[model samples]
Each structure stands twice: as structure tokens, then as C-alpha cells.
Target: MDNSVLRHDMVDGLEESLDRFPDAVSVAMRSVPRHEFVTDGPYQNRPTEHRKTNTTILAPTAVGRLLSALAVEPDHDVLVVGAGVGYTAAVIAEIVGDSNVHAVDITRTLVYEARENLQRAGYEGVLVDCRDGADGLPEYAPFDRILVEASAVKPPRRLLAQLADGGRLVMPMGVGEQTLVAIEDGDVAEKFGPLSFKPLLVDGEQTGSIVRNRTKREDPEYEGRGWHAGHGWEQDWIDWEAHH
Candidate 1:
């Protein structure tokens, strides 16, 4: 199939799935080349019916639907986690403008690929960093929007702390059966349909003694990653209670 034809088909699928955020969805679909973000594998050649493998590109419809739920704004300063191959980031770059998009991924290869793909698509102002998504980019703190591509048992406090007062965050929550959760003002304001994403993996391992000491010393309300530390739900619940 011609690349342009496939691109059009992907765009059409995005429009169909992202009916809610029409303008944002359309801008992303029209601007980002899906093929550039996908690998030349059996999955890319048969996206319509293919299930994504570990390295496969996410379905266009899924990406579009998630982006629609994010409710991004033109002036929003965005942070995208797990930005594989840069397709989603490129689309977001188009929607929020390149100057406002900052993306990070844990994999070095994915980072390189994303940078190349974004450049190929003529997208500028997107900064791709190879780092752990859970940690987030602190230097660019107080972002207007944050999107996480992977699922976590709980939302990371590091990521939440980076949100501006009114900033919004979209991420997959839960273990076996994940749901797309939207966080705003330290509360889960909206939830999309069920989604299954790979679990987030962070680096390093701390001893139980260290974890115990840290937990004891830290505020009871503050749960840094530690032994028997609760998931994102605990922190999210605390945040919600505090806000409410």
C-alpha cells in the first residue's frame, strides 16, 4: 500500500476514535506520519488487525483516543513519557506546537528513533530525553500537561509534583486490568475505557532497612518509593483527600 494511503487510513481511524477532541485529534493525525513511527515489521504492514508486541507501535486509534481524553491546549507545556519512536510526541507537538512538547523514554534506542522520526516529520521544539519516565524531567517542572504511555500501580508523585496548578495528567493505572486515568488538581477527574499497558520499570534497588528508615523519617503523608510502600492509589487518594 502507498504510504500516503496508509497515512490517510490511519488519520481516518483516528478521527473515528477521537470524535470528542476533534481539533486536537485532527491536527495530530494530519501532521504526524504514522509509518515513520512504526517499524517495518509484520505489525506495521498489518496494523489494522495486529496486536502490539513489546516493540510494536501502539494502534493509531488507541493513541488518538488517549490524546483526545487528555484535552490538550495550544499553549500547554507538555511532557510525554514512554515516547516510543516519537509518533505520538510529533502529533502532540503539532497540537501544542513544538516549543511546548518535552518527551522522555527509558530506552536509548527508542529515544534515538524518536528523535530521528520527529526530525523526519519536520517537527521542531520537541526535546527527547533518555531517562526513567517515573522520575520525570524536573528542570521543566510545572508542566501544563503530562502523558504517560505505560501503566503503573500508582501515579508517581514525581510526575504529579511537576504539574502546574491547573495542569492535567493522563496515565494508565492498575495492574492486571488498567484504566486510563486523568489527574487534575491532585484529583482523578475523569477515566477513559480500560487499557492494558506495560508496567513501568525504574532503576535501582534499596535495602529494606533503608526503606524503613526513610519511611520513618519522612512525613506519614509522603510515601516515597520504599519497602511496603503503597501504590499510586494510596498517594492519589491522599492527594484527593487533601484537595477535597
Candidate 2:
């Protein structure tokens, strides 16, 4: 398939999935070139499956759905973690304008590729950095919105502290079956539903403390059973034991 045709198909599929927020997200999706942010080898070899091949550009539907949940405004300052090849940042930059998008990735190669891709796509406003996604960019702290492209067992406190009051942190949380969590304010967090994502990694390591604490908190056999139940699904029931 031609790059243009593939781009159109992905955007169309994204539009369909993001029907809930048609006006806000679809316009952004249409404006960004999804192909530019993906690996050229994947783009050329498997044009149709390029996005998935490198796990760089997220599926259009997923990006659209997450963007809809973000409710980004034109003036909002957004921080993106696990920026991959910068496709999400580019799309978000289109929606909120480039000046408001700050993106970071842990891998040096990914960070370099993301910067090049964003530049090639004319999304110069996005600041790509090689850093720990869990720690976040403190120099540009107090963001109006933060989006984590990877999954975590719990919200990273370092990242949460960066959000402005009433700001939303959209991230996938859980062990096996991830749930999209939208945390508002630094104190209280809300779970949307079951979601799946590539686990967020820092220095090529999973969030050890966050996962352990969360597991114990959500364990049905734990002393805090009532509290765990009120928090929703029995997180301990997950197959974490199998791997451990």
C-alpha cells in the first residue's frame, strides 16, 4: 500500500474508534503524518503494519481514544512519556500546537529517532529528550496534562507531582490486564476500565516498588481486604505470582 493510502486508512480507523470525541481528536489525527514518525524500514517493508512493527506509532484508534480522554485544549501544556518515534506528540502538537508539547523517552535511539521524525514532519515545537519516563521532565514541570504511553502498576509519584492542580494524568495501570487511569489532582486517582499496553520501563527496568505496593494493596488475602475491594478489581488475583 502507498504511504498516503496507509495513512488515510489508519486515520479513518482512528476516526471510527474515536467517534466519541469526533470534533476534538479526529481533526488532530487528520493533520499529522503518522508515517513519518514510524521507522522507515518498517514503513517500507510492511507499510500496512508499520505502526505495530516497531511499536512506535500507536494504533490510530488508541491514540484517538486516549486523546479524547485527555480533552486537550488549544492552550494546554502537555507532557508525554515514552514518546517512541514521536507520532503521539506530533498529533497532540497539532491539536494543542507544538509549543505545548514536551515529549521524553528512555531509550537514546528512540529519542534520537523521535527528534528526527518530529523535525521531518514539521513538528518543531515538540522537545524530545532522553530521560526516565517515570521521573518526568522537572524543568518543565506543572503541566496542564500528562500522558504516559506505557503501562504501570501504579501512577509514578514523580510524574504525578509534575501535574498542575486539577490536571489529568492519563496512563494505563495494572499488572496483567492494564486499566486506563485518569488521575486528577495529586491526591485522588480514578480508574477508567480494563486496558492493555506495553509495560512502562525505566532504565530497562519495570517499576518495582510501585508494582509491589500496588499488589499488596490490592491483594484479597491481605489484611486490607475491604480497602482493596473498594479500590476495584483484586489486583493481587492477577498472574503476578506465576512469574515471580
Candidate 3:
């Protein structure tokens, strides 16, 4: 089937599963081409990882749920952490004006791909930057909303600090037990529900200098010791993790 039909079906499926999916979220999902983001088989609701960068385009349900919970407004300035192929960023751009969205990713490859994908999808106005998702786009600071695609043991302080006075930040929090946590007004945090997502990487890349800089060996012993499968950075980054 064509992408337009597929997009509609995906949104319909999401709305059928999630009763509270906002009309804005539904429209955004239906507009962005999932096929453009994932250069593979027919578009489906499941996650698809780009082999080159190891960046996974989140499943439709996950994206739908996260976007619905975010409740993005058309005029709001939004930041998308872990842009991947820029699908979420494009969706947000479709809701909020393209100029109102900024996306960041630590993996330079993913950043470039996201930019290319967004451009091809006619969302070139959406800013896709190559930077640590944790630091956020301080240059575009005080965002009205922030959506983190990766899971973290805890909320990153830098992200919380960058939120606008009454902004809302949504992210998958925890390792062994992960929950969707939303911090509204920067101080008031509420746990939504159990969520599973790939761990948020701070300074590691699947390839290139970032991966080369890692002194630790990738072994079974290092799995939960310093890094986690589902949630990256299990330990080590403690100052912010402990306090927040």
C-alpha cells in the first residue's frame, strides 16, 4: 500500500488502541511518512533499526503514546531528544509549525540522516542538530515541550533546567523498572506508567570517535556494571542521577 494509506492506517490503529490520542497527535502521525524514515520493508507499527547507525525508529504505539502524553501545541517550541530518523521531530513539526521544532542526537550519523529524512519529507525547516541529547539545545532553550526518545535511569538535569517556566518534559525513566515520567513546570514530576525503551547514550556512538574513546571493554561483566541493555548509563553519571 502507499504511504498515505499506511499513515492513515497507523493513526487509526493507534487511536483504536489508545482512547485518549489527541486530534493533533493523530493528525501529525497521519501526515509524516513512516516509510521515509525507515528505508526498509512496508511500514508497520513495530520498531525498525537502521543498520548503519543502530538507531531505532520507535514503534507507532510508543510514538503515539508519547506524543499524546506530550500534548504539543501548534505554536509551542518543542525539543526532540534522540531524533533518530527525525520521524518524531517531523510529526511534532506537523503539529507545531516546522520552525517551532528542534531536534538533537548524539550520533552524528543519525543527525545527518535525520536531516536528510526531514528534508525529503518536506520538513527541512525542522532543526536537526548533532549534540548530546542531555545538554539539549540551550541556544533554543526554554522549550515549551521536550520529548526524550531514549530511556534514562533518571531525568537528566540539563533537560529539566532548559525547560520553559511552565514547560513539560516527558521521558522514559529507569533501568530494571522504567516508567514514563513527565515533569511539568520543571519541579512537579509525575510517573505515568511502565515503559520500555533503548537506553539514552551520553557520549557513546555505535561507530566513530565516540565509540573509540570508550576505555572500558564491551563485555558481559560491563553490561549492568556501567551500561545497561534497555537503559544506557546504568551507573557512573551519579551527581544528577542521585539528586534528580
Candidate 4:
């Protein structure tokens, strides 16, 4: 089958499933070639987990739900927390120009592969860097829209602070039972529904890194290999209150 046809069929499947799939996001998803990121079953709706990278490439329905929650506008500065396979960024690039899209990943290998994949997908203008996802790309702070591909107990302070005035951010909120949440003005505006995703991780917690035995960061005693995050204890802390 033609890739374009496959893409359309994928979008059609999402539209039928979702209660209110945004037309813009549906169009963008259909426009981006997911095959550029995944070698197998690019149009499939099931998530393929990569244990090596400790990341899951979200299914198309999940992608549709995220973008619909993100509600990005053209030329909006958007930051994706987990670059993963770069398919989500490419889809967002179609909605907001590629140059306006920025992404970061804790896994160095995933960053390199994401950049290459975005380039192959004709979304090279999207900036992808290898860094702690919890840090929220400070140099490109103040984004109009922020999308976190991973789940967290709470929205990281850095990411919330980086949001432009009146900007919106969407992420899966929780550990065992996560919900797709939309945040604005530093508060949870809405909760889409139950969403399960891998927990948000810092530099040291990522796959293939040394185990985190110490709770506090020992900056002076250790060489600059692990614990690359600016703030440590915050990412470690858990917010117990459920969404009000």
C-alpha cells in the first residue's frame, strides 16, 4: 500500500476512535511520514518499546490524543521532552513549522537517531539535542507549547517555568495510573483520561547509565560522567496530591 494511503488510513482510525480529534492534528499526523522513524509497522497503532533506550514510541491514537491536547498553533515555539523516534516532532513540525520545533532526549543514542530520522523525514529544521528531559531546554525556554512524551508525578518546575505566558503543556501525570493532562498558567486545566507511559527520567536514571544509589548529587567527588542535571532533588521528590 502507498505510504500516503497508509497515513490517511491511520488518521481515519484515530478520528473514529477519539471523541474529538482536532482536525489540524489529524491533518498533521497524516502529513508526516512515520515510516522514516520506524523500520517496521510505522502505521500500526501499537506502541513498540525499546528497552535499550528506555523509551516507547507512542501509538498513533496516543499521538493523536497528545497533539489534540497540545493544541499548537502555526509558528508556535514547541518543545518535545522525549525525542524518541522523532515521529511526534515531525507531525508537530507539520502543524508548527519545523524551525519552531525543538526536542531533547536523555539517551544520547536516541537523540542522534532522532535527528537523523527527522532529517530523513524532511524535518531537519527541527532542533534535537541530547540532554536531560527534565531540564526542559533552557536555552530555548519560553515555548508556546510543550509536550512531554513520558509520564511524571508532576510537571517539572523547569518545564512549567519555560512555558510562554498563556502557553499550554500536556503530559501524562502519574506513576502507576497516569492521566493525559493539559496544563496552563501553572495549573492543571484539564485531564483527558487514563494514560499509561514510562516515568520521566533524568540523565542518571536513563537506560545504560549507572544505578542511582545515592539520593543526593555528589558533584565535587565525582567526575563529569553521570548526574548531568542542574537540579537533582526536585526530580526525585514526589507530589502526592491528586489533580484538583
Alpha carbon lDDT of each predicted model = 0.72, 0.71, 0.80, 0.84
Instruction: Enumerate clash totals for all models, in the order shown.
Output: 2, 1, 1, 0
lDDT tens string, model 2, 1-244?
7776766666666555544665757677767776676545322323222333234456556676677777788889999998887888988898788989999876676777789989999998789998878889999988999999887767888888999988999988776667787888754366656657766664523322244434444543664544232222223344557866
For candidate 4, what is the TM-score?
0.87
Q: Write down the TM-score for model 2.
A: 0.74
Per-prediction CA RMSD (Å)? 8.6, 7.9, 4.8, 7.8
lDDT of 3 by residue, 149-223 (tens): 988877788888988888999988777677887878655377667878877776753456534223333444554
Full candidate order by lDDT, most accurate first:
4, 3, 1, 2
Better of 2 and 4 by TM-score: 4
Q: Each prediction's TM-score against the native? A: 0.76, 0.74, 0.87, 0.87
> On TM-score, who's better, 1 or 2?
1
Off by over 4 Å in 4: 213-244
Residue pairs in clash, model 4 = none
Name the candidate that leads on lDDT.
4
Which digits, one per residue and each the tens of the lDDT, describe model 1 over residues 1-244?
Answer: 8776667666766566454656767766766767666656412323332223245467766777678878887878999988877877888888789878999976666777789888887885799998778889999888999999887877888999999998899998887678999999878899887887765644311112123223233456554445334332233222233655
Candidate 2, position 6, lDDT: 64
- Candidate 1 residues lying further than 4 Å off, grouped into runs, are 17-21, 41-54, 204-244
